[model samples]
Target: MNSQARLLDKLCANIAPGKLEWIGLRSERRGEVVVIDQAEAVVGLGLVGDHRMKKTPGSARQVTLISSEYIEAICRHTGHSSIDPRLLRRNLMISGMNMNLLRYQRLQIGDVILETNALCHPCSRMDEALGKGGTAAMFGYGGLCAKVIQGGAFSVGDAVIRLPVIDSQERLFP
Candidate 1:
């Protein structure tokens, strides 16, 4: 491998483990997000009670995760003193992890494994959910979207660890 590839690989694999700070279940499309303590992750679906559970097979957006750091940043950008994570609509709120770094990488939380696939762009509803300038505040900081890989139970306070990729082809999960 070349020097550039080695540096890129090292950067991508440098994310530190984080803790699951919160979990939210969406009852339906664009509905209120209900905070929960724990839930089961189902492969190809999502959290058991979340609306995304009905998504098509291999749906990339089955799970959405945001960082506490980004949430605080969004609040600062929107001129808010504080914002409840539930209104942000992400399924999981993680602390001490850069959500963006998880893109295309697999994460293990408890017995559940998830592979982040894309950025979960902030929707126009952010204006309603967060307040004016909400969507703009979240631009480029909207967090990440993932699909369930290995299913199992996960809960708040669970340790979130990345599954190191050996190459572009295979990834190990636990």
Candidate 2:
């Protein structure tokens, strides 16, 4: 293998494992976010009561996750003091891991298992939530979108474990 491929593999393997730091669900699209201590993740759907629980045909964005560090980075870049996890509109806020490395891999949070689908690109709504340059500040730091593969209960403080990646020709970025 080439040096770049080896470096990528090494980086992926060394990502610091993270934990579920917070959970938030919006009952309706663009609704106020409700913080929850625990939630039931349903396979093929998403966290119970979340606005995005209903899967759209041909869509892989069943659940959204953001890194707490990423939030801090956005705040620093945007000159904001701090940005609440809920304001980011992602279902779960995680800490420690580089979520971008989990693409094409399975993640275990408590009893639930989720398959990483793709990067959850920042949307225009960011501008509404974070003001002015929110969308651009979150570029490349939006986090991951995943699909629940195993249904179970998960809660704040649960460890986020990245499972072995499935072998496929479909690279995370190509």
Candidate 3:
């Protein structure tokens, strides 16, 4: 590997694991998000009660995660004092680490394992929920999309640990 790759590998590997601050689910599209203290992650599915589990059935976008850090940034970008996690509509709300650095990784939260696949881009609904420029404000701060790899139970306040793979630095960029 080249020097730059070595540097990136070190940086990515050195991340301080984050914490799962909150968990929520919506039974149906446009449904109200119900905050939960615990949840069971189902392999080839999603959180047991979440409608998205059945929506795509083993899809990579099964879980949506947002960092409190990004939400704060989104608030600044939108000129809002603050935005609620319920308004963000993501399943997991994490804190204390940079989710962007952990993309394309397999993340382990308590006993459940999830493969970080892609960005959870802001949808048009953001415009309605967060006001006019919500979508634009969340463009790059919308958080992450992941698929369940190992099914198990997880809870609020659990640790969000990134399970790194070989050559992660390569995937980190592309």
Candidate 4:
């Protein structure tokens, strides 16, 4: 196999299945986040009721996800006894998986299918929500942004499965 093929195989081998631990959404930017047991992932938009749900043409960030493990790490790094996941402003809080590995991959959360868009970059709001040094604490562990491909309902306990990645060129040309 070629080097590119080997790299792709390695990435596939690292796929980690996890579970959604929490969900939060806000009606407006900087608005209060409301915890929900379930949410509707709308295709081309985002989780229903979320302030950032509106689909922007050519924009890749539709939904955001963060790892519960990263949250704990942030708490320890910032010297906080505990930090609420809702304050992170991410649409979903998942656990038992390495979220970074999901980049450039497709995932299925319950019935909704999502394509990883990019790493979610933390903004100044992190400092406001997580206290001082919050933005710096979340530097690389902020999580990921994804585009909703198939709309469906997903609950807090839904399983997060990393789907196999298929090369589109191979599929189209074969």
Candidate 5:
């Protein structure tokens, strides 16, 4: 099997959906992942917005960050606004995976193991944050909300790993 298929199959074995959409990045300044809810998340702060909180909701969206490619693609198509990574507020930005196919997949980027908790629904705050009506464009395309089962330092350039692959009979597939 190809590397991509190997990875996808591995992910499917661990969680219900075995796929990954993107990965995120943040400096050490921002506190590690604290809470991961379907709608929103929380990151512990030594001092709120003192210096490390990249933005208001630094850790709110973990695991999923907007990739440079996605930003470039959207901007190329819209030709109206350029997406600033700062405004994205995601930990890892990515491209390639069909976001719609991420259900029940076990995604492990770096040392952080995550399971897709739930779909990230849109809200008014998104509109205010991304500019008027921008939320509508992003309605179906925001990163996922994942619960981190393991705690570890995740830096940029880390490779994402999926669970080992298993066939229909629940046996490891060659």
Candidate 6:
């Protein structure tokens, strides 16, 4: 289980794309979870997760999350204080969600279900965004990324639920 401080400081149980809120835009392989006109646009459309952001060519892994421990440890190691996940350029800043549990889960923007393809990993952009040599630290720690299995208009406050076809994996910190 995650430490008590981790759970206690959580910002929200979950987030829905708002009418004018940024919900992280996702496409086939390429996705950017940064602030875009109040919307987190997961760019790229109609491709599989791997087809999009290939550091080389063949690695199917896309956007992945930096583990809580990894993130916190990096901050401590770097002598930095007060970091916000959202500011790190993630499409959606999440708490209490597990990558395995979300496997096959149907993400929605309105009523459309985005068939998620895979998780996104860190890159040099992370180092540029965070600080010097931050990318390496973000490896395996950056939050997961996904493609739009289904697409439509999504707004904040929309309910996020798993699809029936996918099994909810065991929670990591549970």
Which candidate number would show the highest lDDT if scored against the true structure? 3
Q: What would the TM-scores of all predictions be?
A: 0.90, 0.86, 0.90, 0.89, 0.53, 0.50
Error of 2 at 144 (Å): 1.0
Off by over 4 Å in 2: 1-10, 55-58, 166-174
For model 3, the run of ten residues with the poorest summed lDDT: 165-174
The per-candidate count of clashes, in order, stands at: 0, 0, 0, 0, 15, 37
TM-score of 3: 0.90
What's model 2's lDDT at 152? 98
- Once fitted onto the true fold, the runs of candidate 4 whose alpha carbons sit more than 4 angstroms away are 1-8, 55-58, 169-174
Q: Mind giving the per-residue lDDT tens digits that candidate 5 earns over 65-119? A: 4445556654554454677654555555545444444533445555555554355
Per residue, candidate 1 scores C-alpha lDDT tens digits across 1-174 of: 556545645787778799999999987988889999998999998889888898556788889999999989998899988889988899999998766567768889999999887889999999998888899999988899898989999999999998776666453222
For model 6, how does the per-residue alpha-carbon lDDT over 1-174 read when each residue is reduced to its tens digit?
Answer: 246424422422252322213333344333443343322223334222322343422222333333334457557755568566544555544333444345334445454454444555566776666788777766656655455544444445554554443224322232
How accurate locally, in lDDT, is each candidate?
Answer: 0.85, 0.83, 0.87, 0.83, 0.46, 0.44
Candidate 3 wrong stretches, greater than 4 Å:
1-8, 166-174
Q: Which window of ten consecutive residues has the lowest lDDT sum in model 5?
A: 33-42
Off by over 4 Å in 1: 1-6, 168-174
RMSD of each: 3.3, 2.8, 2.6, 3.4, 9.7, 8.7
Instruction: List candidate 5 stretches off by more than 4 Å.
Output: 1-78, 165-174
**TM-score comparison, 2 vs 3, better candidate:** 3
Write one digit per residue (lDDT tens) for candidate 2, span 20-135: 99999988988899999999988888889987876442357888889988998999988999998888899999898876677766789999998887888999999998999999
- Kindly state the number of residue pairs that clash in model 4: 0
Worst 10 residues of 2 by lDDT: 165-174
Residue-wise lDDT of candidate 3 within 53-170, one digit each (tens)? 9897878889999999999999898888988899999999999988777677778998999888799999999999989989999999999999888999999999988766565333
